[model samples]
Target chain A: MSDQQQYLIIASHLREAIQSGELQPGDKLPSEARLSQQFMSSRGTVRHALEKLRAEGLISSHQGRRSQVLLPALTQDFDSVVSFSQRCQEAGKTPGERIHSREMIDAGPRLAVQLQCSSSASVLALVRVRLMDNTPTMVERIYFPEEIASHLSDYQSSSGSMYQHLVERGVEISHAHSTVTATAADADEAQALGVAPNSPLFVVNQCVYTADGQPVWCSEQHYLPELASFSINNVKERPSPSFFTPGRA
Target chain B: MSDQQQYLIIASHLREAIQSGELQPGDKLPSEARLSQQFMSSRGTVRHALEKLRAEGLISSHQGRRSQVLLPALTQDFDSVVSFSQRCQEAGKTPGERIHSREMIDAGPRLAVQLQCSSSASVLALVRVRLMDNTPTMVERIYFPEEIASHLSDYQSSSGSMYQHLVERGVEISHAHSTVTATAADADEAQALGVAPNSPLFVVNQCVYTADGQPVWCSEQHYLPELASFSINNVKERPSPSFFTPGRA
Candidate 1:
């Protein structure tokens, strides 16, 4: 296995042991050298695995003492937008969607700028509520261009998972770009999310693209902070100097 | 220039032309072939540049019509954490900071759990406000381990940017992990940010590490979403069948 996968696997095994109560709080973990011997990994690899556990607040080694259990595990967080679907299945929870409204509307100046279509073009707009185990968690405002909207023979079933329908129609979703910001819930959003009016929420705006580079759909989703968020790891580039031509953004 | 940088430069040139009124709304852009010849770029490269401009609503091509200027361009977005400092300098805005409070406190169970230190250990905690154009934009709550905290001979000037101080102390800051979530401003946060209680804000939690993999400092920064946010681009992984041992997180 690759070093990355090796460390993560060791961390996962230790995490499961702690979660299963095989290793209680204040219990000492095996020595790093012993773990390296058992897993046939380098000493650095074992330390990395232990550090991963420590980063999650699971284990700690301090003041020349051996590593010991500190706290229980947390719900694993997801960074991808597909996490809403992937994490639910991982946790064995049923993921669902409820369509609140769908209508054909004129592509007004604002949305026309988004879909790159004329203002007179007809667009399919929808308001959908995503649920986890029947509890509403997110409210989404979605828009599709006229070319895609006109091909919806069974819009209801397809709306729940447009990816499946699109795949069957020979469309492959390749990538997406997303922006996340904070917002206060409006009355409509609060009602749909079952939160108090003006509650704080995360608003994620994304544009999905097909493999052929066509913009397929755009969505603005509002999520309760307690239920959803994202994380990222960043590396600082030590730019000795950057003198490339064009100096592009 | 590389293909990626080439397209961005062309798009930037167009953006500036539109912003300076050299290109007006409904003005026709030169043909892709013509642009390719002008920039000495491949046709595909020129097309990518125009497509980028179209994505930002600066220009658009309609059915069987030449590409024309559409809506003006939007503000360029940033995906990196250092964007706050870099963007302000680019916009010629003065970025400022104010230290509100600093104190040495016992690492309570809550924070000790985060720092991996004993509850009785001393930790340095500080609160500071970051400003842009003399307007309060964010409030930061930061903590440091005892070892690093004790090395602070001149904590005042250094707190503005811990990076410079750490570098001077033979420490090289490397990478960081961050989480983004939305929250309602508490009373203390509201007063610091000059906003109403319950105002929606973006809370960024970050753990910074040194080059040798030691955790250096942790900070929880609260930002007014209207002023600051982040974006990301993601790709859907097509997982082929896998039977490898040790499936890890």
Candidate 2:
């Protein structure tokens, strides 16, 4: 094998060991001489493999001490709009959804302004708990305008992707505006998410618009922090001002 | 005044009241008749002003019920990269930094890989407590390579903007990659941030890179969630995938 490919292979092997818990957080990695001997590679190749892992923030190394493992954090892309199910599938985890409630109600003042409709307009509200590997991860509460609500009477079976459902129905999905905040879960949220009351939760409020800038749906998702996080890449071309700001559509 | 100008002025008045804590969270707003009488405006104008506040996520309203105020959250834009001091100044808050430690050390395994240097290379590490209005909000630990470290010995006086300082030194910062996760505060982190042991904290790990793709610095910032949150706008054009996947330069 090429010298470059050998380091990649060694890195992947060590990465799998870390992921499988064979190498745990704070556990010291084997010495470079030992790793080189075990992998039948040169010291330089072993160091290159270890450097790859370090660059990924998986292990910490000191000058004279062996590298130590770090707890792996689950990361979610904050720049793209993807369904929970798609995200789970990509991570090789089973995704499930349990419908909690689905009902049609008059658009109250808050919903009216968000939907840009009259206060009396009828809207459909769907609340469901999103699960990863049968563990409750997030509770999503979504509201759809009457036009889209008319098509999904049996939403319980169709709880997977509302964005896809809307797109199939000729509603062109465009961009989304999302706000992420941390909050302590209230009793209702705590029970729904299967966490202690007042546990830290990552709350994401998002509004999805259509191609013509018409608001299609607004959702509030409460996520258990242990199971989820977000990542972003800030390019100099479009500098981000602050970590949290009211984004204009 | 024009009708549009009247509603905006009333909305700003209520917004200022909320900001100043004259109206507390969960406190009911005055009746429309009372507000119209107080402001000497028409009932329609009062309702329009309330709607504006509602759209801003400041207050909640229901049919035939008084609106309730909401707790204001400090939001940071995740897309734009700005200094904490700059962000505070933009929000009309004073920013301060307390240096905890600034020392030169050998590049350990983690630092070596992150800085793309040998373990024998010397790097400068700086730890500081970030404050907003004299209240501790975050603890930042940053590491710089020898090129930058050689020039910055008195970081305490130069703590205003590390990016700006680097820019003034002829370092062209291109972009940064950041990962946001929730973690329980350890003893040192807890004490520095003035939070209880094991309190939930927002941890952001970021690596800034130069224009030519050279890694400049790596930072780990632990934020008090009560004082900070993150915001992002996801457009359809750039679809981000696998947040933890090793990002290519």
Candidate 3:
């Protein structure tokens, strides 16, 4: 087999070992040298395999030692475009949502800029509380531009994935930009999420764009910090003298 | 000049206007068509210029209307590799630090894995609170491997930037991995940041690496959410069957 395929095969074997309890949580993986010997793959390939598992949070790698199998972890990776419900399913959890309210409203000045639509435009607004394993976890206040909102009338259930539903209806999602911050839960948010007032919530301001660069929707989601967090891996680039605002990001 | 150059020049002019108070906050920018006509550029180019300003938080853009200049904002962009102190100076804010303590400690099993070092290896530990404008904003618990830690002794001051100090000392810094989560402030963190215990804080778990993939240091930073937050721009890629944990990022 080719090097790429060999590495994937090795990763698959390890994944199966973890899933089947062959290598239980807290078990140290075989040393890289032994894995390289057994698979007849170069150490680079072996390391590549390990990195993939690390990205999945299935294996924890510390330098100069064997990696350890981790307990099933629920960590969000902003790098992927997977829908929220699908992700919960992947982690063996049931996902549900309650539509607290929905309405067609005129885009106010603030929402107009956020959705990149004309001021006074008609927009669809949705307020939803998403639950994982029946526990409230996130409160999403989402707005959809008129054109995109029209497609959702038929597939508007919260148990399924809105991202997938839109995709099925031919919404070619191109990208998303998100700003993550923290906020103290207000009375309404606190009640909805079963948290005390002034408890911390992760505020994610996000905009979704179509493939042609049209803004499709915008969402302000408040997430419970206790359950989920964002994992980002950044590589240094050539110095660009770009001055950023203080530790905001 | 090329189209790229044209856009940048336009951005610079707009930037100058804002800084010079020619375009005051709450004032509307000229329409894209007018800007294009004035600059002898395409509407696309003018929009690109506007996008640049939006990224800097200097302007807010809504479709079918003029953009508005914005008040100065303090936000962080994780995409840049600039040092914290430098960023503060760029924003015209004073950055300071108070080093609580420093010591050499053995890398226990937990820390060893975190620093990616051999267990029982000598490690350096530093605890400090980073300040902006005389207000304590973040508490950083930092750990460095022996090699990198040794270089830190000479330049260990709270007033200067450790990132710059390391670079000046010939450390070829690479990229970083960060997991942004939320936590309720403990007594110690609350006392350090002058906030009530159980107030929400942003927990940034980060590890910096070298060019050759060596781990340089690991830090657990607690940020007062009122002062700073992370802004991220994500572009969607080809659909991968990858599953992520729920809304972590």
Which number leads on lDDT?
A: 3
- Name the docking class for model 1: incorrect
Two-chain DockQ for each candidate model:
0.17, 0.15, 0.21
lDDT values for all models: 0.66, 0.68, 0.71
Model 3 compared with the native: what TM-score? 0.66
Model 2 segments more than 4 A misplaced: A1-80, A188-195, A237-249, B1-82, B105-107, B119-121, B187-196, B237-249
- How far off is model 2, as Cα RMSD? 18.0
* Candidate 3 per-residue lDDT over residues B1-249, each given as its tens digit: 655468778988987787678877567889998999999998867876775566444565455668776533322333343356776776788888988888999999988887778899999988889888888988998889999987888876666578878888999765566678788888988999999999999777877766555677888888898676665443342111122246554
Q: How far out, in Å, is residue B44 in model 2?
A: 48
Clash pairs for candidate 1: none
Query: What docking grade applies to model 2?
Result: incorrect
**Per-residue alpha-carbon lDDT of candidate 1 for residues B1-249, written as tens digits (9 for 90 to 100):** 876468667877877888788987557888877889888998756766665554333454353456776433433322124334445555666666788888999989977876768999898998888777777888888888888886665755522556556667876555555667789999988998899999999877877665444566788888888876665444343110000110111
Candidate ranking (lDDT, best to worst):
3, 2, 1
Rank candidates by TM-score, best first: 3, 1, 2
Candidate 3 deviant stretches above 4 angstroms: A1-82, A158-160, A238-244, A247-249, B1-82, B238-244, B247-249
Once fitted onto the true fold, the runs of candidate 1 whose alpha carbons sit more than 4 angstroms away are A1-83, A238-249, B1-87, B238-249
* A3-102 per-residue lDDT for model 3 (tens digits): 5467668977887787678987568889999999999998866876775566444565566878776533322333333356866776688888988898
